[model samples]
Target: MKKCRASSRILLIGAGVSGIAAATRLLQNKFGNVQILEAEKRIGGRINTIPFGDNVIDMGAQWCHGEQRNCVYEMVKDLDLLDFTGDFFSGVRMVRSNKEVIPLELGQQLYGIADMSVPKGSNAEAESVGSHLAEHYWQEIESQLPQVDRALATEALECFSRHESSILASDNLFEVSGRLHLEYEKCSGDQLLNWRDKGYARFLRLLMKVCEDEPEELGALEGCVLLGKKVVKIEFIDPDKVRVVCEDGDAFDVDHVICTVSLGVLQEQHERMFSPPLPAEKVNAIRSLQLGTVDKMFLEYEKQPFPDDFVGFFCLWREEDLKQLRCSDFAWLEGISGIHKIKHQPRLLLVWIGGPHGRRVELLSDKRVLEGLQWLFCTFLRFDVPPPQNFFRSKWFANPNFRGSYSYRTTRADELDTGPSDLASPVMGGDGYPRLLFAGEATSQSHFSTVHGATEAGFREADRLIKYYESCKTNR
Candidate 1:
C-alpha cells in the first residue's frame, strides 16, 4: 500500500457495484487521490429494491442470479452481508397455458435441465440456453414427469415455456437464438436478500459507511474516493495526465480515468462528448456491443384471482402463439428466498422483460404494457383475470440517463466475453509518457458485464499506471 500511495491519482466514473468494489480495493491498496464521480444521486445502480406492503420488491435485480458459485457470493461473505443459505427454489409453482396452476415438485421434469449438473452436455457446443430450448421438446421434458398426476403434464409444459419466456425478449420462444457462453449459471442468488428490507432508501447509508472519505495519509480505497462530484469532460491533455472537468466547474488532473456508465448513456451520447473522437475500432466495438432492456411490470390486485398457496412462474410456449406475444425474454422468477412475501393472499404479480424484445416492450404506454401482459397471461395462464386497481412498471430504456436494462449482449456469445482484452489499454503518449487509461465492462474482454469484472478492470488500470511509474524510475 505504501509503495504506490504517494503521487498516485485515480478518477473513477459511476458508482455501480463494480465501481464500489474497485474503490474498496484502491483504498486498501493505498492508492492516493482517488475520486469517484456518479451521475445519479445514489449508488448501487441496478441493485434497486423498493418497499411495498409487508415486503420489499426488487425493481432492478430480483434474483441472486447467475451461477450459485458466482463471485458476488464471496464479496457478500467478505462484506458480511449475508444471513440465509441463499437457495432459489422454495415454494415454487407453475402457471400453465391451460390457466391451471400446479406445484412444480409434482413435475420435476421441467426443472431437471435447469439444475442439471451436466452443463457440458448443453454448453460444450457453445450453444446457448435458447439453443437448448430449441432442440428439446415438451414431450421429452414431460416424459420425465409422473403421468399419474395430470397436473404434472400441465405444470411441466408451463414451466419450460416460462423459462424461455423470461430470458429472450422475443414474443416467441422459437426466436431465442444463441450459443450459451456462460456455463456456470449460479448467480450468488442471495445478496441483500433481494429486497430493501433495509429498503433502497437506506442503501445510501451503507455506501456512506464503507465508501466514505479517507484519512489524511491513508492506504488504497482511502482518501482517494470522493462522492457527489460529476465528470463533465475527459481527454488526454499532456504526456502523463488525462484532464477531467466536473459539472461543478472543478477540473481534475489524473494519470488515468475509468469510465463505467450505462451502455444506453454511451451509445446515445458518446459521439459529442469525447475529445479527438472515439477511434473507428472503438466506435465499431461500441456499436457491436448491444445494450438490452428489461422492464419489471408490477401489479397490485384488489383481489387475488390466483390461489393463495400458488407462487407461480408463468411461461409462454415455444410455439407460434407464444412468439406472437413477445413473452420469451427470460426464464423464471423463483420464490425460494420469497422476498416478495407473496404468502397468505399475496398482493403483487411481477414479470421481467429483456433483450431487443425488452427494448420494444418499453416503447408501449402503461395501458399498452398491461394489455400486452394480460394477453400474455391469457396465452399461458389459460384462465381469465380481472384488471388490477393498482399497477406499477419500469421503463429503463426511455430514460435517457439509463438507455436500456443493463449490460450488453448479442447472439454471438464470444463477443459478449468482455475482459481485459476488450477494454481499452492505456499506453504511453507521443513521448513515451502514460497518456490515458480506460476501464469498464466494455473495455474489459475477460469479465465484462459483471460486477467483479468492472472492479478488477479498474484495478488492472491502476496497476498499469503503477508499473509505468516503476519502469520510468528503472530507466532513469
Candidate 2:
C-alpha cells in the first residue's frame, strides 16, 4: 500500500484553500508524488491578503466565520491568530437616504426581527428566503410599530435585505432558496472572528506549516505548487490515467486528479475544459448552483472621520428615492449596503456591494467610484466627505479565476433537486477507480461559502483517495 501510494501521481488543480488543504493532507498521508497547479501567479485563490495603508488588508476573506468545528479557527486558535473585537451589527447606525437618523433602539429592533425572520432548517414553508423574510418582517412591523414608524421600518427592511444579499452573495434574497439556505450549519462561538493585522493569508501559511517568526514561505508545500499553471483541459487518457493540460502548453499525466477550482470557474469552463464532457447531472448541478458576486471597496483616509468605536452606517434608501435615482449614472451606488470601519485598520472604511452592481462597479473608473462615494456619504450621512488617500476594491467578478466571491443555494437549485452533493460526486473511470474528484467550498453540503467548508471538502476528497488505496491493499 505504501509503495502503491508513493508511486501514484496526483494532480490538484487550483491553489486555493481547498487545493492547499488537499495537498497538505495527501502529503501527510505519504502521497509523495502530489502536485498543485495554480491558475494565478500567487497562491491563496480567493484568500488574497495584500499590503495596504499602514497594515495589511484582506481583499478576499477577512473573517473566521465561527470557532467550534471551524477548520480555520481550530487550525489557528491556539496560535493566537484570532481577534474577537467589535460585534458585527452592534454599532450599526441606520441613516436613511433622506438623512434621517433612525433611533439606535429602533434600528436594532428592526435588524433583530429581520435576522430572526430568515427561515432555519429544511422544513421552511416558503420557497425563497426573501418571501419568508418579507412576509414575516412586515407582519412583525405592522404588529409592533406605530403607523409613522412603519414606513421607516419598511425602508430599514430594504437595507437589511441588501445586507443579507451581500452575506448570501445573492443579487436578491428572493432568489435564495429558503430551505437550502438553512442547510448551511453555523459553527458555535464568534461568527465574525477577525484576523486583525495578520489577515487571512496567515491561514495559508499555517496550512503550509510556515512558522510565525520565520520569513513567510510555503514550507513543506513549497515545491509542490506551480503557479501560472492555468489548467486549460482535464481529460481521462485511459482507465487508470488522466491528462491535465495548462494554458502555457504544459501538460502532466497523472494517476488521479483532484479539481479544487471555484464553482464559478467550473460553471464558466466545465463544458469546454472537460474531455468527453461531464455527466448531465453534473452539468445540471453546475448550472443550478449560483456563484454570487460580493465585492468590497476599501477607502483609507488621512484623517479618520468617525470615532474609534463606530462600526458602520447602514444606508437605507427609500423606495421613492430609488425610483428617482434609478436612471442616474450613479444608480449602481445604491447597491452599497453599508460603509463599515475595518477593525485593525481604523483609518480605512469597507464598503459592501453585492449582485450585478458589484460587477458593474468593477468596470467603473476609480475616480467615478470616489465621486459615487462622495454623493453617497453626503446624501446618507449629511457630510461633505473628502476623498480618501488610498482606495482599493476587489474585482472578483471581473477576475476570470474567480467569477464571483462565493456560492449560495438558489430557488432554481431546489426546483432542480441539484446541489453541492451532486457537484461533489466523483467521475469514476473504466478501471472502477475515481479518476477525477471535485472539492471546493461549493462542494461542501453543510458549510458552503466558507473557508472551513473548503478545507473540509479538500480533506474529504483526499480521504476518499486514501480509502480507495487502503481498500486496494486489503483486496491484495
Candidate 3:
C-alpha cells in the first residue's frame, strides 16, 4: 500500500459518498491536512435523509442494491443496520387505461416474455434492448398466437417498458445501448434491500465513525469537512499543485484533488469550472454519457386508503393511447411507473416518476402535484380519495449540484468508443504525476449509478495517491 507524504495536502470536492469515503480512507492511511468542500450544508451528498412525522425518510439513495457480494450491502450488514427485502414487480396491480385491472397472471406472463427477449448470448451488445424486444413482438405478430393474445402481449410490453424505464431512470428504451444495458457487472444475491428503520443516512454516519483512528481523531476528521463550499473553479497552478476557488471567495491549495461531482454537474459546469478547459477527449467523454432523472413523490396521509396487504400498484397505459401522446408533453402521471405503499407506514405511498417527465414534475406547485396524483389514483382505482395530508418530492435533476439523478449507457458516446473509463482517467500534470483525479458513480464502469460504485472509486483514487507517495519515499 502506498502512503502519501505526511505534509502533502489533499482536497476532496463534494462530501457525497465518494468524497467522504476517500477522505476517511486517506485519514486512516496517515495522510494529514485532508480537506473536504461540500456544496450542501450537510454530508452524504445524494444520500439524503429527512424527518417525516415520526419516521425518517431517505430522499436520495434508498436501497443497497444487489446481494451478498455487493460492497454497500456488505457494509450495511457489517453495521447491523436493519434492512428488509425488496421484491421487484411484486404485488403490482397493473391497471389499464380503460380503468380495468389486467389479470396478475397475464401481466407476469408478458413480463416473462419481455425478459426472455433480452439476448443472453454474445449478440446482446450489438443492439438495444428495446429494438430486440420490438423485433420479438413483430415476429410474434406473424406467429400463430391469437389476436387477443397478441394485443395482450403488446400491452404487457408497454407496461414492461414503463416499469423498466423507471427502474433505469431512462427517458426511453431505444436510447439505451444494448451492451451497456445488460452487460454490467453484478454482485450475487437479491437485487434490492431497503433500509427499513433508520434510513440510508445512518450508513454515511457509520462510515465516518469507522474511519477514525482514535476517539479524538474523529473530531479532527469531522473538522476537516467544510459545508456550503460550492466550488466554482479548479485552477491548476502546476503539475504538483492545484487551487480550488469556491463561489464564496474561499480558496484551497492542495497537492492533489479528487472531484466526485455528478456527471450532470460536469456536463453543465465543466467548461467554466476548470482552468484552460478540459482535454477535448475528456470533454467528449463527458458529453457522451447521458445523465437521467428519477424523481420520487412521497405521499403521506392521516389514514390508510388501500388494503393492508397491498404493497404496490402499476398503472399500465394502453399502447394506442401512449403512442398517440408524445412524451414531450410532460404529462407527469403518464410517466409514473408505480406507486409503492410504505410497509412500515401504511399511510405513506411512494410514487416513482422518471425520464423527462420527472423533471417536469419538479416545476409544478405542491398543489398541482397533489392534484395530479389524485387524478391518477381516482382514474386507476375507479374511486376517489381525499388529498394527501403531507407530501414530499425529489428535485435531483433541477439541483445545480446534481443536474440529474444518475448515469446511463447511451448511444451518443459510441462514436468516440468512450465510456466511464475516459471519464475516470486522471488529468496528468506537467510533472508526469496525476494532479486532478475523478471519482464518482458515473465513472465506475461496472457499477455506474450506484453509491457503492462512487464509494469504491473514491477509495481507488486515494489508494493510487497513497501508493505514489510511498514509491517516492522508497526511491529517495
Candidate 4:
C-alpha cells in the first residue's frame, strides 16, 4: 500500500504559494512522484521580491495580515521575522489637492470613521459595500463636523473608498458585496505586520523548508519544479490518467493533477485550457467572481525628503481639482489613494493604485509616471518636487500569466449564488476517483484573497487525495 501511494504520479500546476504548499505537503506524506509546473521562469508567483536600490522590495504580496489563525504568521512568529512598528493609520498625514494639510485630529477622526464604517457580515440584503459605507459615513459626517469641514470630509471619504478598492482588489467599492466582503474571516491581532527587511518571499521559502542562511536556495522541493513550463492544456485521457500539455509542447501523463493557478488565470484560460470543459456551475462561478487589479509604484529618491518616522500621505482631491486633472494626460493620478514609506527602505516611497487605473498605469512608461508624480506632488504638497533617482512598478494586469492581482466577491456572485466552493469542487473521472483538483486563494471560502488562504487551500486538496488513497488501501 505504501509503495502504491509512493508510486502514484501527481502533477501540480503553478509554483505559487498554494502550489508549493501542496507539493510540500504531499512530499512530506511520502508521495514521491510529484512535480510542479510553473509558467514563469521564477517561482514565488505573486510573492515577488527583488533588489531595488540598497535593499529589497516586494513587488507582490507584502504584509502578513494578522497573527491569530494566520498560517503565515504562525509559521514565522517565533522567528523574529515580523516588524509591528506603526499602524497604517496613526500619524499618517492627509493632504488635499489645494495644498491644505488637514488638522491631525480631524484627519484621524475621518479616517477612524472610514475604518469602522464597514459592516460586519450581518447585512441580509446583499447590497454593495460602497452604498452602505457612504450612507453611514455621510450621516456621521453631518452629525460630527461643521458645514465648513463637510467638503474636505467628503473628499477624504472618496480617498478612503479608493484605498478600500485597492485592498479589496475591486474596480470600485460599489461593485463589491457588503455581506460577502464581511464574510472574510480576518485573523485576530495586528493586521499590518511587516517582514522587516526580508520581503514576502521569505514566507514562500519557509513553506518549502528552506534555510534562512541559504537565501537563494530552493530547499526541499527544488528539483520537483519545472519553470517556464506554461501549461496550455489539461485533458483526461482516461479514467485513471490525465494528460497535461505545456506551451513548449512538453506533455506528461499523471495519475492525478492539482491546479493552483490564480482566479484571474482561470477566468481567462479555463475554456481553452480544459479539454472536456469545466462544469457549468464552475464556469459561472469563474465569471461571477471578479479578479481586480491593484498595482504599486516604487520611487527611489537620491535624497530622503521626509522624516525617519514619517508614514505616508493620503491624497484628497476636491471636485474642481479632479475635473482639471482629468483633462490632462495625468488623469490616472486621481486613482492613487496614498503614498507610503516602505519599511526598512528609507529612501523609497510606495504608491498604491487600484481599479481600472491600475491597468492604465501599467501601460505608461516610467518617464510618464514620474512626470505625473511630480505634478501630483507639486500640486498637493505645494513644493518643488524632485525627480526620483529610480522607479519600479508592477504590471500584474499586463502580465498574461496573472490577469489581475487577486479575487473578490462581487454583487453578481451573490445574485448568481455561486462562489469559491463552486470553483473548488473537484472533477470526478469515469472510475469514480477524483482526477482533477483545484486549489488557490480564490478557492478559500472564509479566507479568500490572502496568502494564508492560498496556503490552506493547497493543504485542503492534498489532504483530500491523501484521504482517498487511505480509503482505497483500507478497502483492499
Candidate 5:
C-alpha cells in the first residue's frame, strides 16, 4: 500500500515586506519548495533609504505606524535595529494663517471638532477624511477663529486639510463611518508617531537575512526572483499546478501561486498578466482598494533658516495656489499643504500629499513640484526657504511593478475583510481546493500604509499555505 507523494513548488510574486514574510515562514517550516519572484532589480519594494547629506533619508515607510504588535517592529527588534527617542506630541511647530507659527496642542475649541462626527451622528458609518474634517472643523474653529479673522481659520483648515487629504483626497470623508474614521484618525492623529534611527530600510535587510539563512530550498534561484523579468501572465494548469509566464517569455510551474503586487498594479496590470483571469470578486477588491501616494519633496538647506526646536513643519497655501493645484492637470497638491524639515543640520523640506493630491503631483511638471515647494516656504516662513541646493522627490506610481506607494483609504476604513491575507486565501479550484492566492499591504487594508502590514500579510499567508500543504500530506 505504498504510494508516492507528488512534489510541487509554490510561487510567490513581489519581493516587498509581504513576499519576504511569506518566504521566511516557508523556509523556517522546512517546506519542501517555496520560491519568491520579484519583478524589480531589488528585493525591497517600498522601503528605500539612502544616505542623503550626513543623515539617512527614508524614501518610504519610516514610521512604526500605529504601534501594538506590528510585525515590522518585531522583526526589526530581533535584528537589533536602533530606536530613537523624541517627544511624539511636543516636538511639533505648526505653521498657520497670517503667516504665524504655532504648536499642535488640541485647543479647547478644536476638541469639539474632535468629538464631532458625520451628519447622522458621531457613531455614524462611512465618510472621507476631508469631508469629516471640513464638517466638524469649521463648526468649532470658526467661532473661535472667525472668517473675518482669516489667519487662524485659514491655517486651521489648511492643517486639517493637510492631515486629512494626505490619505485619500478623493475619499468622501462625509460618507465614511464615524467609528473607523476615529480609529485611523487617532493613529495618525495630531500626536507624533516618533522617528526611527535604525531606519525602515534595515527591516528589508533583516528579511533578506532570514531568507538567506538557508539557500538549498528557497534561496535566490534562477527560476525565482527574476529581476528585469516582469510577470506578465499566470495560468493554473489545474488545481494542484499553476504556471506563471514572464514578459521575457519565461514560465514556471508551481503547486499554487501567491500574488503580492501593489493595488495599483493589480488594478491596471492584472487583467493582462493573470491567465484564466482572476474572478470578479478578486478584481473588485483590486479596483475598490486605494493606493495612496505620499511623495516627499526633499530639499537640503545649507543653513538653519527655519526654527531648530522641532524636527519638522507643516505649511498652508494661498487660496489662489489651492485653486491652481486643483486643476486636474495641476493636481493642486502644492495648494493643499506640506511638511518641512532638515537633513540633520542643513535645512530640508518635504511637501507631502496622499490621495487626490498625490495623483495630482504625478500630473504636475518638475517645475510645478519646485514651485509648490517654494510656495510652502513662502507661505509658512514668509521668508522663501530657498529652493534646495540639492533635492529629490518620489514618483512611485510610474513604475510598472509598483504603480504607487503603500495602500490605504479613508472611505474604505469600515471594511476590515480587505486585509492582505484575503488575497492569499486560496482561489478555489473545481474540486474546491486552492489555486492562486493574494498577499500584500493593499490586502492588509487596516494596516495598508506601513511596512508592518506587508510583512504580517506575508507571514499570515505563508503560515496558511504551510498548513494547507500539511493537510495535503496528512490526507495521503
Candidate 6:
C-alpha cells in the first residue's frame, strides 16, 4: 500500500462505477474529506436492476465480460452472487425468414468470412465495415454460397455487422474508425458472466462493503454519496482548490476534483460543464470519440413458447421483410440480433437491438413493442404465439444523464489513440498541481466500454493522486 501525508478535500462528480471506485480507494487511503455528486437519484449509473414477476432482471449492464479474468469478476466472485452463464450449448439455431431452420455452423461460417473481409492494415481510402465486406467478399460469397443461400447469407451478415456496431454503441460502421480501429481486449477465459438474481448492481454493494471494513482511522466510505446533484460547472479556484457547482445551486469547494461522467455526457456538456474552458486538446478529444447506444428489451411469456433446447433465434431477412422495411422506414425489427432465452428462467426472453433501431424502439409503447414482437414470432416461429405478459425497453439514448450507452472508436479518432489518454489527463493549475482529474470507461485505452475499464480508471487516478502527495511529502 502507498502512503501520503498530504491532506486535501476531494470531490467526485458522478456516482457511476468509476466514481464509486475512486471514492472507496481514497477513503481507504485515509483521505479525510471526500464526497460524490450524482446526476441520477441512484448510485449505480449504468448498472440498473429491477424486480420483475418472480425473478429480477437487469435493465442496464447485465454481463461481466471476460469472466474470472475480469477485475470486476475477481472482486465479486466470492460474494456467491454470480452465475456463470457462458455458452452452455455449442451454438444457437439459425432461423430463416421463411421459418426454415438450418445448421448453426453455416451461419457462423458465413459470419466468419464477413469478419475476415477487412484486411489487417489500414487503407489510404478508409471504408466502412459494410462497404469493405461488400467490395472484398461479395464475389467470394457469390461463388462459395449456393444461389439459394446467397440472400440468406447477405441478411445474416447484415445482422452481424449491426450487432458489432452496436457493441461499440456506434451509429453505423461508417462512423467507426477504419484505420487501426480500437478492438476490445479479450480475456483468456469465458467472455460473459450473468449475475443470477443478484443483478450487476450488486457490485456497488460490494464496493461499499469493502469501504466499511476499512480501519476507522482510514475514514469510512460513509456520508460520501449525494444523488440527484447534477454538476453544472467545475472551476479551478486556485492551484490547490476547485469549486464545483451543481444544478440544484449546491456548491462544493475541494482541494481536488475527479470527474467520472460518461463519454456521452462529456460529448454533450463538456464545454458548458467546465469554467474557463478545458484546453483545446481535451475538448477535441471529448468531441472526437463518439458515444453509441445499445438498448435491450425483456419479453416475458406466460407460457413458454420454444423448446428448452433452443438457446436463441436470429432473424434472416426475407425479400418481403426488405420490402416492408422500404415501406415503413422503421422495420428495424428485421435487424433483431436475436431473442435469447434467459438461462434458468424459461419464461423470459432477452432481445438486444442497436444503433438507430435501438433508439426508435425505445420510443414505442409496450403494446406497440409487443405487436412487433408478435409479428416477429409469427414470422419466424412458423406458428401463432401468445403475446408477452410483460415488456421492458431501455432508453439509454434518451436519458438526459446518460445521453447514450457507451463510447466507441470513431474515424475522427483513427489518426491518434490520444483521445482517451487526453480525456484521462488531469487539469493543471498555475502552481503546476492537478486540480481536476477525469476518469471513465472511455479513459481506459485497453478496457474501454467495460465495467472493469471504469473500475481500473478510477484506481489509476486515485493512485496518481496518492503518488502526487507522496512526492510532495518527500520533497518537503
Which candidate gets the maximum lDDT versus the true structure? Answer: 2
Candidate 5 positional error at 154, Å? 5.1
- Per-residue CA lDDT of candidate 3, range 1-476, in tens? 22246778889999998998888888887787788999987778889988884487888888787766567887767656755565643767777767787777666656766776664557567777678878875565445334545666667777778777776667987877776755567776666667776787766776787442343233435688888999999999866789999999999888888999999999999999999788888898899888889888888888877665556677776777566544533367777888877655667888888887788888889888887788677766865567888888899998989988888777677666789988999998765577899999888888888888888898888998887776555321
Better of 1 and 4 by TM-score: 4
Question: On TM-score, who's better, 1 or 6?
Answer: 6
Task: Please state the error at residue 200 of candidate 4 in Å.
Answer: 1.2
lDDT of 1 by residue, 205-277 (tens): 3434434243222233344445666666777776557787877888888866667666657677778656767
Off by over 4 Å in 3: 1-4, 86-89, 119-121, 137-149, 210-220, 319-330, 472-476
User: What's each prediction's TM-score?
Assistant: 0.69, 0.96, 0.92, 0.96, 0.81, 0.90
Instruction: List clashing residue pairs in candidate 3.
Output: 2-466, 2-467
lDDT of 5 by residue, 368-418 (tens): 777756665565565556666777777776667887786554344346434
Better of 2 and 5 by lDDT: 2
Tell me which of candidates 1 and 5 scores higher on lDDT.
Answer: 5
**What C-alpha lDDT values do all the predictions have?**
0.52, 0.87, 0.78, 0.86, 0.60, 0.75
By lDDT, the candidates rank as: 2, 4, 3, 6, 5, 1
Off by over 4 Å in 5: 1-6, 78-85, 88-91, 94-98, 102-126, 142-151, 167-179, 182-197, 210-224, 318-336, 342-347, 363-368, 409-424, 430-432, 471-476
Ordered from best to worst TM-score, the candidate numbers read 2, 4, 3, 6, 5, 1
RMSD (CA, Å), each prediction:
6.7, 2.0, 3.4, 2.0, 4.9, 3.9
Q: Candidate 2: where is the Cα deviation over 4 Å?
A: 1-3, 86-88, 122-125, 146-148, 471-476
TM for candidate 4 is: 0.96
Which candidate model has the greater lDDT, 3 or 5?
3
